[model samples]
Target: MWGGNDSTFLQGNTNPVSGQVYTMYHGTSMEAAKKIRKEGFRQSVAGMLGRGVYLSRDLEKARRYPLNLQAYQRVVLKVEVNVGRVKKIDKQGHPLQNIWHDHGYDTAWCPPKCGMVPSGLEEDCLCIYWLIHKSLSLAGVIICRQTKHLQGCMG
Candidate 1:
């Protein structure tokens, strides 16, 4: 009962030997973004998916991060992730839930509405070193305030 029904679940890579590249979003404070832009991403000590850099493929989800911060104070970073050897943690208390990384998985994924996340949004935890490839450059920035539009870029 804990693993849930695989038949109704969306198709995903359950066991992968190689890595896959994906575009993901990471939301953080502008202050922290400055540091990340300099040093690079760091792995979290603990989380739903254990130790890794948490990200989401959903832009809206990324936009709502640092939950306590106002929209204007938050920075949504668009990142390209190289998730190597992914493990699907679709439900709570999964056998490999927290130790996927130790078992050779470079990334852990929780699909949207899988009942694992309270918000029902998809989430991913990737090993810090593999989270970014090449250079972390700012492509563009869009400020959405009610109706007005302002655009810019950092770095």
Candidate 2:
């Protein structure tokens, strides 16, 4: 996800994926470097959200049903974005997630009115981009919780 038309590349002491890691590289142009940075950051955010969602779904189900898989709540709720750490709560706080999912909009086609949009976006690119990112984050928290629980159970 980190390529552009510029001659510069993203070079630094810290790894782009991990805020704590470090690295160094050369970019072809300043523009290229910036683009790389942005793309890297975007990928990192996306990865985090994916991880969070995977955890949250399990944790949420467990929390709501209290280990009674047979009594698990069959909620038809639209997926929410799990942005950083997630709390074991019933409601999500993101407005975009609420509006898009609850209102029955095809998020992939959401538009921003911009002339050009990222791949997978047919309409509101910007809004959809942010919404997707946030939703992933929200889901990620649950994934984290689920993983932790699984680890505990296994240990």
Candidate 3:
């Protein structure tokens, strides 16, 4: 999962959330995570309006959330430039891990974007958005945009 400087640390081990008061894991896999969730760790903060993860389910109330429109525009332009380098593809035809360099996630990480695509559904097409990302240039930004226009855009 993508995180930021302001992210809160958890009490769990391995994962940051493990060390937090809410998450507890006994095993190394999903079973262990589930066990921890079932056990329920002690969290000082309880249920409240827009208090939990992602700052409440209400977008309107969370008016303080930050955004960078200029950065967004830059990324979009970068995507337009690199959308043609897509070589390999996945089952749904979305770009898979680039064959050359996959270090952008490590070297030039960007906050993950979602909600446009349905859960479990592949915006195999939207890889262009990331593939063209300037931070993921060269081996990372390799997508063919001309061939796929608005294929991933929902609205």
**For model 1, where is the 10-residue window of minimal lDDT?**
1-10
**Over 4 Å off, model 3:** 1-81, 91-120, 124-155
Best by TM-score: 1
Over 1-155, each residue of candidate 3 has an lDDT whose tens digit, in order, gives 22222323232111211111211111122332244345421221321111111111111211212232221121111111112222222223224233212422211111113222222211112122342333221111111111223211110
Q: Quantify all predictions' global Cα lDDT against the true fold.
A: 0.68, 0.23, 0.20
TM-score of each: 0.76, 0.15, 0.16
Could you give the C-alpha RMSD of every candidate to the true structure, in order shown? Answer: 9.0, 18.7, 20.6
lDDT of model 1 at position 150: 51
- Please give, for residues 66-118, the per-residue lDDT of candidate 2 as tens digits: 23332222121112222222111112243443234234332211222222222
* Sequence-dependent TM-score of model 1: 0.76
Candidate 1 residue 43 Cα shift, in angstroms, is 1.2
| Model 3 residue 76 lDDT score | 15
* C-alpha lDDT of residue 110 in model 2: 20
